[model samples]
Target: METNLSATTAAEANPGTARDAAARHGALGTLALMIAHCAGMVDVVALPVWVGTLIGAYRLDPQQAGLLPTLFLAGAVVSSLFFSPRLNRLPSRVAATLGFCVAALVFFGLASTGRYPVMAALHAVAGIAAGCGLSFTHGTFGRSRNPHRLFAIAGLTLGFFAIAFLGITPGVIAVQGGQTLFRIFAGVMGVAAITSALAFPSLRPKRVAATPAEPRFDRAVWFGMAGVACMGLTQAMMFSFVQRIGLDRGFGFSAVTATLIALGFVNLFPAPIAGLLELRIPGRRVVLAGPLVQAALALVIAQSAAFAPYAAASSVLVAVMIFTHTFAFGMLARLDGTGRAVAATPAMLMTGAAIGPVLGGTLVKQYGYGSLGIAAALIAAMAVFCFSRLERRPN
Candidate 1:
């Protein structure tokens, strides 16, 4: 409490210039944070692309290849544990800027590394830095007066990037090879460092953790974390290996790939709607509805023989997943104004993602797609139950 006061009081006391500057920073900070996420996402997007490159270049087997992202996610989850809790306690500007700088430097090193052991180490370190950056970003989003809209914008931005990823990654891989993705990542990091340094103060206020706005954790807080974690678990499990499911269905590789690509449209459309509906719609309804729809759709997507139903099921699955996250995240921001629960967002997401492939792969290998689909449906049903526990608020 004593520590929190000094930092926030100092900012509150300097009302004129600091307030004016801080006021101007909101949108700029959002942009910086969003772009930083876009840049930091090399961990998520580059894995499949670069994994093949790593295998060919290093003569590594599939299991050895799997270690790349596993260690990277491990680094993120561990670092977020240590770093996210400090967002309110520490100087926001310094924390965010320093994180971006660390990520930039590590990614630069990632570009230059050649040895398999050394490259893995660099990627792991880079993941830690990226996790810190995300913690700061999520922490920033947590404090927004309208977290739903903010997260929606972030989701829509990701949607655009998903489209760009489809177009750009393939071209880069074809022309420049996989190492170029690291170079691109390094450049994105450098830009994020600069943007965060310039706009960090606008991101969020230097509010004290002990302030009335941020209360001690309670059932609602834990419930919110559990909800998002369940959300992450279901999505990652099926979404990670969805293409394999498509292939197993006997769909042509081109048709399956096209359906997968088409699914990107959901991110562009429904994600923003989920954000907008935060103000107009009750969070519980959207939250419950999202997984309900996903559960029904997942059953079909996991098993349907007809290509048309498969495509439709996959599209709706994508839509509801994004919708669930957008509204559920908004509900989290509302529950704990202090954003502590919100700070756990990335951890819940990355941890679930890290677990998904392993579990999905194992289930598919053992029992078949029917078992995997049933598993996804069950998890999605769980998310519905968990999200229902949230304290209902009027729209």
Candidate 2:
């Protein structure tokens, strides 16, 4: 009799409870956004590895090699400003799917093209696609009811995709050659894009009721930009030069790549933890702490003679770096409280990413790899200063 009564009560509660659950899950809308983010990860993971090899194969100088990644980031920055806002007006699913398809095509073209100029152009196209993907995915997911969970899912998805590509791409290139790998990647991304397009919900655009626009040049935005810029510069430097650091330490190509891949693996698990941490701790504090930790690790790696210690330090550095940056993103979304504002965040981020490598490469030419640690430390200190100022401002 008691069991029957309990069942009846649960059944009576089902409709309201189920609706709440759906709201928490963000229905189908959140899944669509996650898929779009996963599609973008395919390129972000693969590009650094490819860039290193492409530079060697072309026998380009460091400056010339640096230009390739810079151009790619430049495209992202420009497209974010021009294309991202427009995507909000289009059907979200279609815009995201089309962007992924375009990126896949460009990736395939890049693999096929032998000439440096042609490859560079395709990379730029890929960057534009990346900008669109990032913009739309952030916009869609940020607006979801359960944004923190969605962001965590997005970060984990990106990290796993990165690890998979970093682990597999080199072996695939060795066994099947670059062209075949490109074809396989393109096909895979194409399928994902198509599936995302089909599975996404028909979302009615939310009306933005007119209000006084916030001042464009706010102190919060500038401080956020500085922190993001510092992180980007650090990442770009590490991405561009970590292999060289390994090689200089007498590690083999496979070992160097494996160490790099390990960083991505570490990244896979930390994002959700970072998201949870953001809820308990202040975002500025987390962001400030990350660079200090990274700088310390970089110094250890720079000075370490043994491969094991260097690899361990490097991996931890990257893991923490990603964790803090992902956390910062969540905080940015919280602060913005709108999809468009979140979409705009990447544009600010790309500016830092674009400049970091070029500057790092120049530094390398002038002072060599040993200077990288010191430079990173200084940049982190600057980020700390920027965040400190922002923290003092009245909300």
Candidate 3:
């Protein structure tokens, strides 16, 4: 009797333990999504720093410098739209792991290649590989039980990483010169490639029946996509040539480094707060705030020539831009029950970013950075109008 009672009690406890283990597994999977995304997200900021090398080594003008990021983003757009959609038949682990590995190799190429054409080509290829990894990773994260919460966590993780990199990378670059950006990029990609195999949790469902049509792209979805692209354009305009602008103002290397570190630390809160606010505010309003803030940044950039004021403005801009970026995609998450839509969202962002660099660079080279301010102001107003229309339209 005693033995039977003990056996029965043990069996009852097994279910709870299983539940606990499953919860832990899911949390780990969410963390993996963050790590995977962070690996890609760092590339944008890296370009501004790397431009120093391109200009010095290749005798390239600012307009030509823009091509590198443009091509990189173009590759991301192509892979996300055409390649990743086709890769759904592959197991998530197989796709994500392979893509990460290939991308890592390309990053190594980026570190080693000194020529302009070779470096550009390598980054474009790396972008394609990154897109595939992102597709798989996004799908994996979207399947989490608390996707909104997970997104908040993702935002928080990115903010923290941004801050840490801002703090450390400037010092590294100071010591190692322009090549440090490439080396750091390679190291980050290599680390991600190794860790990614274990980062993604299985997205397979328990149902024997067919899965629901989640991640649907209705009219609302397309509108949100457009908005993301515009946001990307705005971001590229603001960040890509900023180093040149700072140099023109006579800001020293130390000043730039200190400002970036301060800015990064400040942006850490806005992402998480934006997520929390999305729970209360109309989603459109939350997103609209991003552009308005960006416009403010443009004004500050145009008016303030000093490093102190510029630093303050840019830091706030980074904070608000990231905060809004999280919510803009959150709209997609709300619509995309299947999570595939969210996977494609990053591609759409890349598409806009691809266009932004060349356009912004040309404008800056011809009309100057002040023209960028005007462009951003106009774009910000347009974004507000477009978002208003999107909000009024029903799902």
Candidate 4:
């Protein structure tokens, strides 16, 4: 306890020392964070396959299928909102291990159930637990010496996981059904639980002197969070349906699955590339371009009847989000000195995502796939407006 206080005192005294301390545990810290990133963001790769499995194997309509993942993301958003502010008071490893353990158990339970109500409840439980763990992981990342580079490295790790997950899980679900998919989720949470227990670095929040003044986020932080949420919405809305869109358009199952694999391969480059270009490019320029590019890709994927256009657009859509969000993440970490704002990463991300699948399902049911492009355009406009409000930063 005395050592913790001393470390905290020193960290509070010098910001550079805090960053260097985080780097001192670099290898183990990075690996733990990588595993946590894969575990927390599993939804990115899992959602499409998950929703499709519910539709095909479980015999549900698009709305019902979409609702499950929405429930999971909503649960995450709620849990993140609750945990982000309290992270400093908690023991990082214990909190993370406990969260992942509960999530693992809930996922195992998810594997055993086919009932919609049961599965919905389990997903919410798993999301809450997983979100808690992720809050710790991202908060620690924000405390690092070079958060952008560290986050990019973690993003690269996630890209690798995406390839393995996208390559394997869909085929397994096609053969074995929803049970296999839930079991895979369980295994992921279990691994996260184990790795966090063994390797999570010591993290002590910087001490703020006691005062009557309230701690509040700057206006810019809210704008950044809003921008990320908008992008998240567009991403989930389009991605959740890409597989179904391709298949419904008479693209063969093999071709559609191949596109998913290709999407994974495409994902591998964006993060490292973003990391390398960090100093060369201004993040605001990237931020300004992100939503527009994302909207265009959505337009192409949604309106394209041809297999070639659809595949091409779908393959690279996620890479845009991954790349743009890396810059956004770094910028937010810099803007919010307390780390509390960046700790709300799960909330900022999953809040829009929570609404996306269900909203897309409703749109597809009511209008058609083309309506998604219209929606993306509208959301992108809002994201652009929000990002425009961001204060410029020097490289």
TM-score of 4: 0.95
TM-score of each: 0.80, 0.83, 0.86, 0.95
Answer with 1 or 4, whichever has the higher TM-score.
4
lDDT of each: 0.65, 0.64, 0.67, 0.85
lDDT of each residue in 88-128, candidate 1, tens digit only: 66666566667767877877777676777987797778778
**How far does residue 105 in candidate 2 sit from its true spot (Å)?**
1.2
lDDT of 4 at 139: 76
Clash pairs for candidate 4: none
List the lowest-lDDT window of 10 residues for candidate 4: 1-10
- Candidate 3: regions farther than 4 A off: 1-25, 56-59, 83-88, 205-216, 391-395
Question: Residue by residue across 1-395, what tens digits does model 2's lDDT show?
Answer: 00000112222233112112222323354565566676654434554555465555555666666767777777777877775454334565666677778877887777676777886787688778767766666665555555556677778877877777778776776566556555755765676577557655333332333222322435665677578778777767656766667776788888978887897888788777876665577666777788788778877776677899888987766567567767666655555543455565557666767776677677777887777788888888987877666543111
- Ranking the candidates on lDDT from highest down gives 4, 3, 1, 2
Which residue segments of model 1 deviate by more than 4 Å? 1-26, 40-67, 104-120, 174-176, 202-214, 247-257, 365-370
Stretches of candidate 4 exceeding 4 Å from the true structure: 1-7, 13-23, 205-214
Of the two candidates 3 and 4, the one with more favorable TM-score, higher being better, is 4
Estimate the overall C-alpha local distance difference test score of candidate 3.
0.67
lDDT for predicted candidate 1 compared with the true structure: 0.65
lDDT over C-alpha atoms for residue 385 of model 2? 79
**What digit string (tens of lDDT, one per residue) describes model 4 on residues 162-268?**
89999999888888877899899989999999988888765655354621222578898899999999999999999999989998999988999999999999999
lDDT of 3 by residue, 90-189 (tens): 4666676677778878877777667878988987998888777777666554544455556677767877887777777767766766666767776776
Could you tell me which 10 consecutive residues in candidate 3 have the lowest summed lDDT? 1-10
Task: Supply every candidate's count of residue pairs whose N, Cα or C atoms clash at under 3 angstroms.
Answer: 0, 0, 4, 0
RMSD values, in order shown: 5.2, 7.5, 7.0, 2.5
